[model samples]
Target: MATTTLGVKLDDPTRERLKAAAQSIDRTPHWLIKQAIFNYLEKLESGATLLELDGSAARDNEDRGELAEDAGLQCFLDFAESIQPQSVLRAAITSAYRRPEQEVVPMLLEQARLTAPVAEATNKMAAAIAEKLRNQKSAGGRAGIVQGLLQEFSLSSQEGVALMCLAEALLRIPDKGTRDALIRDKISNGNWQPHLGNSPSLFVNAATWGLLLTGKLVATHNEAGLTSSLSRIIGRSGEPMIRKGVDMAMRLMGEQFVTGETIGEALANASRFEAKGFRYSYDMLGEAALTEHDAQKYLASYEQAIHSIGKASHGRGIYEGPGISIKLSALHPRYSRAQYERVMEELYPRLLSLTLLAKQYDIGLNIDAEEADRLELSLDLLERLCFEPQLTGWNGIGFVIQAYQKRCPYVIDYVIDLARRSRHRLMIRLVKGAYWDSEIKRAQVEGLEGYPVYTRKVYTDVSYIACARKLLAAPEVIYPQFATHNAHTLAAIYQIAGQNYYPGQYEFQCLHGMGEPLYEQVVGKVADGKLNRPCRVYAPVGTHETLLAYLVRRLLENGANTSFVNRIADHSISIQELVADPVSQIERMATQEGGFGLPHPRIPLPRDLYGAERANSSGIDMANEHRLGSLSSALLATAHNDWKAAPMLGCPAGA
Candidate 1:
């Protein structure tokens, strides 16, 4: 195992406390210290700070998401929003989102009571479908796989297995070529199998069939001899044919997504969105820059996109710039916490250049949210950009924050303060996060204290509302943009805004193609004629190849059995279960040890340390030369042999 050396300077009393805490947890002081260091380093590396990732009840757990997840999501939202809402469901979301500040504590415990069983059953059903695919593959051309599973699980299982299975299948195997082969087989050859039955998606079906047909099954059964021999014979000689099949499948799969590969195509699409009530944030999709050359190329593409959007949107609301979001990771290879100062120094010019371009075009430029670890540094860059003299006048500058994170509220608080002090109204777009599975897996691999996001979907929903409340309440310092496809969440926002709502006070956002039905209702184009809030559509503009990760994330997010979209789509699931109040869910969770995610943290919140300075996130700002220099001097003094015994954060052994 690889490891880094960590040094600590603790006073006798502090060491004693560490020892006691370790003892209480039945761990060695060394173990405790290392754990603390690991967390501390992760925070620093991920751009979290003492005030950002410090001790708090909500200090852990967060999540992130993608594009082209519309068709099924649109269908589900249309049903839920139009259906006579279960009164309980309405009351639950309304009460939760619209509740007063004092009416707090206990979240989702009741919802858990009501929906936990159904959710579990739904998961079991989905898992069984996946297993059936596995079994049918093992059985080699078993004709009854899909039909048999559906009969056993029943017909309503479509929602359980639907669009989610494609992602689940893709997620099962990490190898791109193997996955491609699997997908190809499902779409083309799987269609040929009558007994294999229909799969969730053509892609998913193709993946299932590919599993059975492509690889050699591990077992040697007499029942499989003829088929197995054919498989080996074909496998050895079918390389050229297999590649052609995979390529064809991928092409067909690309049809639903991949709006256009070029900016001109994206711009044409954006014009259509503008015709609707929806505002567009055009994203040119690609990964982080592996080389400085790639970073320059990306920066140029962003500038061009901004120019086009600015030209088109110039005459609109002065405050509303054409929305164009970019990823900082895509701008630099060293966009990590470990690189810290170097990233800040390098990013400053690039961001300043981009922000300048946006300002020039009067376009809203937001930093797209990436993995949780990248957040801290991203925020640092944004904070600095907000303060930069060149773009100080532009409030169109903003970034996304995933509410699924335990640290979201704090991050919001930080931004709100930064916005206040910086003399620019920072635009805050709150999302429910997208990268849950990967984030969780990464944490486990690293053996961190807990997941960085809410494990339960409802918990993330709760966090979304809480953060929304803060943003709505502070409209002067920040503009709140709530992005979701859930009808309940949409209703909550409506109630929270009350009768005094303005279209722009707080806006709603959904992925461009997703929630088409929901947006219509929100804009009051529906027959009932209740005009909802102003909504923005989060759309990605890129070719299919570059947009694959984004598309896959959308699938994983919405396809999971526990997913809100999937649950409501399951028609057999009652409204009562779908909209169970989170407050009650927490109450039910409290009955069990380690059940409710909320922590009665033993340590004080890090924000408390900064007292009044913590307000509006000014406490976390580091642009102050005096403060930075003092800290730098201290660290430099301790440069060798612990910086010549000069102080840095924690004090000397004796103080």
Candidate 2:
């Protein structure tokens, strides 16, 4: 066998043993070492232990000198001395005797066992194991429990599958007592506190409980096979109860959520309260319309929503809570300027009418961004609407800016300039854009210029900070909505605003469900004059089926991107202790995989790593991200839906 030389470093005792062996072999230490190494290599190739090789006999005669001083020579001599000829021969004979009998005979026996009758028996055994596991008090058992609950709740098969996922998470908890406690808590409280304590047992139990309560369990399970299923069923044919359950689960998971009724109710509630501290932007859901007809329908639906919100608020003498947010793709996808204009022509008259009505009721309108391809169209529409004589007032119109887009800085400047010219207040809602993965994929597929989705996390964070600084610097810009749930981003904005001392002038906008504690803290401080800020929930309203896409998107954003939990755990553990007990760190990482900020199945990696390699090693994927987003989005969307729409537009034909 061909051999490669391997360098060796040896201790004194080992080197001395080698020298003695080389002397006994009656050969030069280097020559004896070479022979010893060759013999060991042959044994290795033959699958023999070095100690079982015959040539080791010679090692005793050749190594009596101070060749031990040479570490490499000592290593080879030591290896040669280990070979035992009798042991090697005995092992070879034994292997030969057993191999043919067992290996050859088992093939025929195995083939016979695979015949029809045997195959039937094997299938039966497999099925029995599966059934037993499903019913056992394990992870699979919890899955069964969720399955039963889904049936009892009359959820669709997909929804049922999603719910069962929550059950599986519950099963992952190690302690039986904690698991039982969590189940009892869920049954009694109708809510789950997944991040109760930092202990491993508590973390697992709480995460499992939270999954069930938030409906993320189902969503997480659904992540694997059904990418488009939720969106398809949303607003299509699912039962209202299914939608309600989805919404509830989503809210618990902390996502921005919306549903038709909740948005209307929020608007109505705002109007009734005459809430001067906040403004509302209503969004109508539905997207990727390939035809102008569908787009027109979308536009009409939005216009109707706008008018309904205005009318409702008018009845309550609330003039400010009437802004409506619209997605351009919902108006029509892939349209030329004129064709788009024609759809807009149909939409504009109604939008103008809504504008006229908003003038009477004092409502504002903001347009939302869609796919990157449709972004220019969305911006053009916003610009046109902003310049409209009827809606020229600063409080009456606004546009959204996705900070991740490379062009946003230019867009921000453009909007600011437009606002200056109109002598109107510009309401710019700043968001880290959605559809990041999709944008990247599309850019790659189309061979586009730049990745609008900031690949680096720091870049995105800095972009938000920079934009906030720019907007806050320009007092005429009305310090548009800072729409984010990131603590770091939020704190930075708060610090900047504090330094500038324009707290009330800027509004902090969070999704309806996410970061409730943070939102409350920020708003509470504002109320106490500690921060002095206005806050608004970008409350969305649409049917549950229609809202799942948004829900999925939110879960993806929160669960997929951040790894605060793992980092916190690592920091909490001392480096010296971690090094001494590596397994402890591994176990901690494993446990943290399901802790708060580390949503199960999509748990973030340890802080020391980067990119997809670490994520894949942890078994997290895009699907898990999507499911988390969907679950959180659904409930938040529903909460917003249930609120009364400010009556500026009529409900669509059906609702």
Candidate 3:
């Protein structure tokens, strides 16, 4: 075989051992190393379950840290220094993820192999419908997008996201006078905002005024005099009657949520999904807590949800966990970096309790990613819990990585390290991210630096693929779960992951109601009569009160012009563009600093909040922080407290 002579920096003992192993194998040292890599890959694929480590094994690994480092170097040499280019590494993923005729033909033939004509006919019909939708995508643009959003009744997700984006954009206007001046100018032209009277602009403006516009529409259409007669009632959804109206509309549209009055009802619905060859990670919906009371209420809800899921989950097996995704922000009002020490102290205890409960029940409790600012704090708590002795034996704890963030790859590295240290296998759900518009607008408004995310749709896609390649290769540490609807992206992942990766090693996730056809294709039986892949449906369980905002964000994602679901049917866009090889895409997008790596956010970040400190590497005991925090002791001691019948003496005096 053709190869490059890889130089190794080794001490005498290691060098002698390598020579001895080579002699024992009756092969050159390089040849033995190459064969060992092939064996490891074979070990992963041939197994029914993915690789995992135990605490004892991990401790042994730490003892042989030098050897593990050598193994890591060996992995790098094997994967990166291949005979040909490492195509998966430098690939710039195109936004459009298109499938080819040849790829479809094999699958069609596989479908024909099925015994049932009805099933074959159904598959053909689905394929035709999917193509028709793809051909129709590009023509829609802003007007098409607006109508799509409107058709969805402007609920919490993507359809409603334009409004959130608009609201965020308006926040960038620092001066109230300037904001009012712009509004007045738009009013003169019979529009709500500048250039917002028609087509796409109208859609964006409506989205910007999302809830606000919804209230107006309620008033205009209510004719019941319920809203028209009460102007404030129509405009402010937070008002009693108006909030009721919003809930009614949400239930009518289904709001892409699966909530019920009780956890049992929701789990029953989830069971139907499980029966249909899909797994679920249920999210109990609620906004970030505004007070300690709200936090306590949410904690109770979570504690109950865990108990319910654990009871329901049986007969399936280990890691077939009753997966529930949690938002830490909802667990505490003070979940911020400025309160890092206190937040960690406060949040860890609650999370630990849940983690222990999860351990008791064999359920997966994942910490979901939220806004960019809270990323550091979330990671700290997650890592702390991951390493906690209570969780060392369990494999179900998970964390989400948002590909939209520029530092997502870096985040993945940290997770892998955390898992390795703890000797735990982690489920990493890689998502394209939800709060794109918010992140962009926040950066702009803060006037700190450039955007925290990629400006182009392709950049995020590229970043996701890059991260996926890393995770999929590290099967021992991470169980990668990619949540995407883009067929092109899925196909690229399947292709690049190589023959060693089993469909079971990683999972594909789609929104509960969305991407049905795409996932059907993914997990569907092929020519060999074997299932293609297992998939997860991210199901949100919550009431109407928690539904609206989530719905708007989902709408924003779906309604965006760059979204694959939106543009898949657009005929003007070439299949090549949709499925361009990332490697070539990177070559085309090359710059002086290499391809697509942008400068860090120029605005200062709150470093204190970050779990991973940048400098001052060595931490002595928390002496300094303790001294600084001592000032708070007196304040707490002096705080108001009312109890014991308010020290009543009036009854005694009267007697």
Candidate 4:
């Protein structure tokens, strides 16, 4: 190829700076300039702004050339250093787990401190929102199937527990033999006849009638005489009908929770909500991959979803349009800290590819938060992604922080610092958290010193508000996404965010089916009911087969008697009690108990799990990197010592 001469003038200082930046990485100024021009044109073609063509962009081009030229020790060193910030982040994350609830609560209170006047304003706003949500006409003037089921078969009741277990596990069972048995076991055990007409939901009542009849038919399978003969006939022929009914019921519940069975369908379903001024962050639902094939399958699904979603966006940009939320575990079989080297070598490259694709389309890609142990590992990936020269100026990179974790406030501080260092804004989604039950049980089983999450729900709420304050205060470096369905939490965040709102200063987030009604009162042009703030719908898109884990989490979250979504539909819960402040609740608890921010009285420490009958045996936390590292070091330290055993034949004679 022939090159044409292009002349550009620069001041002496500017020339020196360019030459120094080029020399730092051992490259000629001429070569750097040519690469920069090529990069600049490529960026322009890809729709990047002039501001994006800063020093970092030029360096990015040079770095690529360097890697190509010397693909040896220097490249390895660079990769190592890029992810080395895990040292700082790991310390922060490790410290978060198992902190004394009493200690953690006070810190959160101080961080979430609100004046009496501000509290009052928050209460008023939250109460108004709650009242409207209650009074608004539901689509059919009745509760949703899930809500109706929860109202009728509460978790405290055996029937409710049975239904939830069946709903959560039915779709994942593969063999027809097992499916039939599960249907028989779950349905036949629950007393469904009395609940037939108790629920006003046609869906719920229909489900009840099916369960009642199926139970009666399966119950007499081993009885004597006519009932037994009739049961045998029904069991042989009508079993398929029972299976079909259960399958339909599961699919119906799945449809209400999941947006669609695929990305294309999800986007089409999202259009109506988009038209109503609501944005979306689509989550492709699947659990952690247990095999490489599983990981690759999920990876392909995410890649396809990104392409389809990007096309659908039509250049609405990151903040204004839809985006994708990815689970890191879904892209790698072993995404644990113990497999740190494997993850860095394998998972990081895949993550970089996805981030680059999202950047090319000018869309956001958020890494969804998972279990407590993976927090720092995720930050390691996120830190590497942020500092990546190719992704340097892209503001579409997103992360999630679970406020229920004790380390949430500290994580916010670290993330803000990182965004400032990377010279780009990061989208941070603040959520109360999922996996609370599992986290608590895991700690108890392991005999860990303390719970990684809060023992009390109110403590988590306080932490959410406190974390929100931290995110809000750093406007330039962070774009805060508050994901919650609680009117009180929403109102407190709304007030704390203040009255003056720009297009993308900050926004609220809600789940797909559950949050729409509540947010309908908040997201539009300024009006009596609307708060005029943007709210993004976190929609899960997947077939019923992949929706098992997601559905279970949603049920556990909303089906709980104390959950905001569960209570919002119950008229017996007064507006005053419904919209009570978490901060105030904590303060009152502290005062009344005379123990400052004590843990829930009902929840015992892992050591005290058995109430003095027998001590719980200790188990290792294989997920905690710090613990694993310490154990490895200790074992290695004693490797040099040896002991020899000898026969004791002479001992008896000598004695």
Lowest lDDT 10-mer window, candidate 2? 97-106
Query: Candidate 1: TM-score?
Result: 0.62
Q: Tens digit of lDDT per residue, candidate 4, span 7-100?
A: 3345699899988988898775666887999998999999877774468978788777765644433433333222322346557766666779
Off by over 4 Å in 3: 1-254, 257-261, 500-504, 527-531, 569-576, 580-655
Badly placed stretches (over 4 Å) of model 4 are 1-90, 141-143, 193-196, 225-229, 236-238, 622-629, 644-655
lDDT scores of the candidates, listed in order: 0.59, 0.49, 0.59, 0.83
* Higher-scoring candidate on TM-score, 2 or 4: 4
Measured on C-alpha atoms, candidate 3 has an lDDT of 0.59
Stronger candidate by TM-score (1 vs 2): 1
lDDT against true structure, model 4? 0.83
TM-score of each: 0.62, 0.48, 0.58, 0.83
Q: Give the per-residue lDDT digits (tens) of candidate 3, residues 346-450.
A: 777988898788778877777898987677567668767887876777888889988877657667777887788789889899998998778756655443223
* Candidates, ranked, TM-score: 4, 1, 3, 2
**For all the candidates, what are their Cα RMSDs to the real structure?**
19.0, 32.1, 19.3, 11.6
- State which candidate has the highest lDDT: 4
Query: If both were scored by lDDT, which would come out higher, candidate 3 or candidate 4?
Result: 4
Instruction: Write candidate 1's Cα lDDT for 1-655 as tens digits.
Output: 2323333445699999987998798776767876877898998998775664455434332111112323324433332222221123222322232122112334322322324554444344333322322333221122123222222222134423332344335534557667645544443322223424454434446644654454222122223556876667554655435445544443433333344577778667666656766677778888888999989988898888888778878657424445788999888888875566567678778888988888876777888998877765676687678878887677788789997776676677678777887988887889999887786565545433345566566677777766777788788878788888766566555555565775458777777544444565565453555454677777777765576677667545544566554454344666555655555565566666454554424322223323466521213113222333345555434443322556667885766
The TM-score measured for candidate 2 stands at: 0.48
The reply for model 2, stretches above 4 Å from the true place, is: 1-256, 259-263, 268-279, 290-293, 312-322, 333-351, 498-504, 525-530, 563-655
